[model samples]
Target: MTIEARFRIDRGSFTLDVSLSIPARGVTSLLGPSGCGKTTLLRAIAGLERCHDGLLKVGGVIWQDGRRFLAPHQRPLGYVFQEVSLFDHLTVVRNLEYGIKRVPKSEHRVSLNRAIELLGIGHLLERAPGTLSGGERQRVAIARAVAVSPRLLLMDEPLAALDPSRKQEILPYIRSLHQELEIPVIFVSHAPDEVARLANHLVLLEAGRVVATGDIQTMLTRLDMPLAHDSDAAAIIEAVVTGHDENYHLTHLDFSGGRMTVTGNAMRTGDRVRLQIAARDVSLTLERQSDTSILNIFPATVDAIIDEGSAQVTVRLLAGDVPLLSRITKKSAAELGLEPGKPVYAQAKSVALLT
Candidate 1:
């Protein structure tokens, strides 16, 4: 199943003209800066904003066509805005009840009990919204959305209004939703960290245009995209926890390319985890060195080199089948004679765990 969209909307000087056919499962993030039509396009999909002429089909259902259009309330979708928007007078159970009541009992796919358990909000069911923390309120809001059994969940920066601490508390729940549910989620966000943590597919928008769209790991390391321009640019690698060295407080994660060991990974054996390796954390060496503090080193072949500026260059590398990125200076590139197909050793200085 997939979501096919061909949207075009014009208002004054700003215009949104884009077409996308994304998978109907997993989390697909609509990532871009402000006023880039991310929200407008999302609203258009929800029927809150009409397109001049468009085609929108979610899975096997046609929500919009040239003339036929489904109103927002008629569509089987759940929308969670930046604000928690919970009723202060209602308890958590009441809020979730409101959502499940909207859909007919025969059409319910996600049960109220399941939503409560999935979001870990069963403990908060009796608490009023005014007494809950920001993170707890958002968790309830998400549970309410799921209680309606939506086929598609649209989140407009649900973490935008929360503080850093609250965001951290809610991210695990968001990740769980992506892992445990079958619903396809279209999330809007300008934060790279949020996208890196939650998204499987990424749709990058800029100034009302579709800049790029593809797998999250591939898109993040693409040297051509604006994401690579950031100083914090990194590559996301999916790995499985093979074992752990309890004596050293280190866990072993194995990916397609090779194995990596990191400290303070509180994951058990056989668990899956995603590692974020910053381009700057990776250093290239002509020959593999044995004596070094860097534990993750693998043989990689240079794929492409793109100049970031006068002083630095971003080199794309292929380690076995995995893609890794390294940002080095122009001087180092010239001295090392770096070129496509050249064999080199990549040393990862640091790795951040994400799941």
Candidate 2:
């Protein structure tokens, strides 16, 4: 499935002109700073915002065209905003039933119980939104959205209203939804870490314009893009669960040319997962060593050496088929005689895992 969207919204003061196609299955994030029109674009896609020239398609169905715009009530969209917009007077179960009751019997693909189970909200079914915590209320809202079994799910910073602790509390449920649900998700957020954790595809917008949009790895390591300048600049990789060491309590994950021993999550043997290796955490070694404490050692061939003026240069490397990026000082590059195709090893203290 695929999503094709374009908008030419001309308000008196703000005009947004963007044309981009997004993937249909994974979580695609509409990322930007505040007032950059991410919310407007999401509203337009959901048929909540009206414009003079707008086009939208989801899984081959046209939600909007130049002359015809599908009514929001008629569209198959489940929307969750920053606020937990639940029926305060109703219990959580009743709120979920509110959405289920709107759809015909045949259209109800996701059951109320399933939504509750998927969101880990079974215990809160009897409680009112006012009685629940921020995370609980947001989970109820998300469960309510999923109960309808819409074709697409649109979330506008669904965790933004909560405090940091509360936000962390609800992220695992969101991650579970992404891993388990079949429906496509369009998430809008300004938080870089949130996007980094949740988004499979990213759209970077600035001043009402889309600057970059692609897979998360390509977007993150792109030095030309704003994300590479972030203090948390990193690279992502998908690895297979090879084995685990019972003695050291370390899980072995396999990637292209080498294996990594990460303090990983629960995964069965042979399961594929994605991991985040931060650029700042990695150090390069010209020769493959034996006395180092580092466990992951890949014979990576340098792909590109980009000098970012001053003291920094980014080295793009190919460890077998997998691509990795290492950020080092220009002085180090000159001292080590590093160049394209020069073999090296990258040592890291830790790697962050998402899936």
Candidate 3:
């Protein structure tokens, strides 16, 4: 199933003209710079922003067309804005109940109890909105949205208002939403890290137009995209935990490329996790080196290279079928005689466990 959207909105000097089909599962992030109309496109999907020439269909159900348009209140979607927006007079439980009341009892797919459990907000149920911390308030807001059991969930920079620590506190719960629920999520954010950690499908927007759309793993590593040239550029690898070394306190994750040993045993065997390997953290070698402290090394074939500034170049490699990226100096590239299809070993100094 897919969500199809076509919209053309004009306001003075700015115009949003886009047409795209997004997969109706997992988290599909609308990623771009600020003022790129990420939020506008999201609003259009929710029927909050009416476009005369817009067309929207979710899972083959027509929500809008030339003659038919569903109003914002008629759409079965829950929207969580940047602000907590909880009523000061209401308790956390009450705020959730308010959202529940909006939906008919027969339409409730997510029970109130399940929403609370999914977000880990049971303890704060009785606390007033004003009494809760920023993270706690956002958790309640999300639970409230989930309690409605909407077919789709739309979040507009939901973590934008939170501080760094508070943002960290709520990310895990958001990740669990994807794991525990079947509802599709449309997440809007300009932050690459959040998109890398949360998005399964990526829709890159530029100046109110669709630049590219694909699975997160492919979109992030494409050498032709601006994502590869960014300083924080990284590759997303989906790996499953193969085993744990109890004595060494390390976990083994296996992907298409190879096994990676990380510094924690918290994840269980056979559990799937996402690993983020930054381009800057990877170094290339002509031969496998066993003496280095870096434990993650995979034999890869060079696919492409692009010069970054005048001194360094970004190398794209294929480790088995999985894509990996390395940022190296021009001199190093010349010394290694690197070119397309050249065999090399990629040494990853550090890897972040995103999930």
Candidate 4:
């Protein structure tokens, strides 16, 4: 199953003309700067915007075409906006019931109880939205959306309204939803950290067009893209918890390329996880260093290099099939004679685990 979308819209000085095929499952993040048409594109997919000559096909359903257009209510989707938008007069359960009641019993796939459990909001069911914390309110809002058993979930900066602590509180629930549900999700956000944490697929927008769209790991590390040149540039690595060293308080993660040890995580053995390795934290050496304090070191082959600025260069490297990025000064790169196919040792100073 896939989503094939083609849209063209013009509003005053801004115009959006883009086409792409998105996967039917997992989270696809529509990422870009402000006013880059991320929200506009999502609205087009949700059938809330009237885009000219648009063609939208989700799974096997034709949402919009030349002759026919499905209304927002007709589409089997649940939308979570930046605002909670909960019914002030209703309890959490009632607000959830409001969403599920819109669909007939014959179409119910996700049970209300399961939705509540998934979002970790069962305890807040009897409370009013005003009484709950920001994170709790957002979790409740997410549960309400899932209660309807949507074919697609559209989240437009669902965490934007929350503070850092609130965001941290609600992120796990969002991650669990992606893992447990079969529904496709299109999330819009300007936060790189949020995208790195949640997205398996990425669609990058610039101005009003899609600049790039691909797997998150590849997209983030692509040397040609602006992400690779940014100070926050990093590589997203998918790994599994192989074991833990109780003595050192460290956990071993094994990916397709190699293994790395991170500070002890709460995950159990065989649990799949994602790791974010910032380019700035990685340094390349011609040979493996034995006196280093870094625990995560891998033998990598240089793939390509791109100049970030007058003094720094971003080098793309490959550890087996996995791609990584290293940002170093021009002097270091020149001294090491870094080039494509050169064998080197990559030392990672820090690795962040994202479930």
Candidate 5:
């Protein structure tokens, strides 16, 4: 097993009982609300927070058990928290070297240059962490982690501290790590968009318990889970660029439907892509509209009607049973007289291309 962690810890009123086995490769997100024990669970797996009952292992290497527990320093882990937490006095190079030097040369599977290159921090190596921007410092922090050549990487909302612009700047670097690096990463975040974009697998926690775990798409679409009830809840559809309108700068996607035209992206013909359309983005119509500006319309039939609250209803749609969710107000549903066997055209206001 790549990662094996079973935690049952109690501290006063807070109790966290979770058992999870994550794959060794790709990104797996630990998602939950604040104080839901995500950070505590990360700490426990890292051996930073001692648990009365725990069994943690990475790469089939036992790090913690009821009888034996490995210390934090002993575990080959690359940890990057929200704070940059670099040595203010030390130059970026030295900060990276600090951990790289700790592990013997024979054990250094990752080179110092490689870490800097991976983080795109080659220029900032001579500067102090204090002189760097928030994103720059965070990149250095990540470089320092990778320099250790850890068996597993654990990050706790590493982008939480950065501003939106900084987050965008660093997201691609994180993506590269997932695409190129060998080590598996376990990241904790509460943001749905982040999970949707970054995580290949998801471990959803609620009240300090493992509520659900699955691929990102399945977790988002499963009606049994609360994720399906989210305002942003929808589906990821893989599509290919079938054609483009030269005059309008519009690209068409071919999925089950012959075409879908979205606003952005200069997609070349035949380039495969993923699109994210929010449930709220979809508006159901009984027949295809010829008068509207909406370019993308799909034939769908209602599968289930879940009343989300007094005002809103969640409709599970089937484009030939390819599940897509649409959120409409309860009043609107009643006005439209929507129900099972209702054939409608799902109109999307926007479709986000997943890069």
Candidate 6:
């Protein structure tokens, strides 16, 4: 299933004109800089912002068109704003119940208990909203939204209001929603780390227009996109835990490209994990080095190369079917004669394991 949206909103100097078909599964992130109309586009999808030439369809069901328009209340969607707007008079469970009461009993796909379990908020159910911490309050807010059992979930920078520590405390609960619920999520954020960790699909907006849209892995590594040139540019790799070295206390993960050994024992065998490899941490070699400190070395074919500045160049490589990025000095690239389809070996100095 897919969500089709077309909207044109003009206000003085700013205009939002976009047409997109977003995947109706997993988390689809709306990523851009500030004042780029990410929130405006999300509001249009939720029926909160009405446009004369707007058309919206979710899973083939028309919500807005020229003939008719569904009001915000009529749409079956749960929205989580940056601020936790729970009623001060209501308890955590009561806030959740308020949302549950709006939905028909017959249409409740997610039970109250399941929502509580998903957010890990069972202990805070009886506590009032004012008594909870920022992270706790956001958890209750999210559980309330899930209790509605809507077909779609829309989050507008749900962690933007929280501090760094509070944001860290609540990210695991948000991650669980993707793993446990079937509802499609539209997440809005400017933070690349959050998008990298949570998003399965990516939609890049620029000056109120859709600049690019694709799977997160492909979009992040594309040289033409702004993501690859960012200071913290990195590649996302999906890998599975193959085994563990008991004596070395290291875990081994395998992807389509090759195997990687990480310095950790937290991940278990047969578990799925995400690996983040920064471009600066990877170096290219003409031949596979047998006597090297880098444990993660794989043969890769150079796909493309772009000069970052006068001193350095960024090289795109394909290890089997997986794509990787490596940043090296221009002099080194020239000496190695790197170009498209050239066989080389990529050495990863460090790898971050994210789950």
Local distance difference test scores for all models:
0.90, 0.84, 0.92, 0.92, 0.86, 0.92
* Full ranking by TM-score: 6, 4, 3, 1, 2, 5
Taking the tens digit of each residue's C-alpha lDDT, what string does model 3 give over 1-355? 9999999999778899999999999999999999999999999988888897799999999999998999988989988988878989988899999979888989988999999998889999889899888888888999988889888999999999999888888888888886888889999999999999999999999999999999998899898899999999999999999998899999999998988999989998999899999999999999999998999999999999999999999999999899988999999999999999999999999999995
**How many residue pairs collide in each prediction?**
0, 0, 0, 0, 0, 0
Local distance difference test, candidate 2: 0.84
lDDT of 2 by residue, 246-289 (tens): 77777899987588888744777898777888777777988877
| TM-scores vs. true structure, each candidate | 0.96, 0.95, 0.97, 0.97, 0.87, 0.98
Error of 5 at 335 (Å): 6.8
Best by TM-score: 6
By summed lDDT, the worst window of 10 consecutive residues in model 6 runs over 170-179
Tell me the lDDT of candidate 1: 0.90
- lDDT of candidate 3 vs native? 0.92
* Model 1 worst lDDT window (10 residues): 173-182
Clash pairs for candidate 3: none
Model 4: CA > 4 A from native: none
Flag regions of model 1 displaced more than 4 Å. none
Candidate 2 local lDDT, residue 344: 87
TM-score of 6: 0.98
Q: Which stretches of candidate 3 lie above 4 Å from their native place?
A: none
| Poorly placed runs, candidate 5 (over 4 Å) | 104-109, 238-243, 254-259, 267-274, 318-322, 331-344
Better of 2 and 5 by lDDT: 5
**lDDT, residue 344, model 4:** 95
Q: Write the per-residue lDDT of candidate 5 for residues 292-329, one digit (tens) a residue.
A: 98887889888788888789998888776467788999
- Runs off by more than 4 Å, candidate 6: none
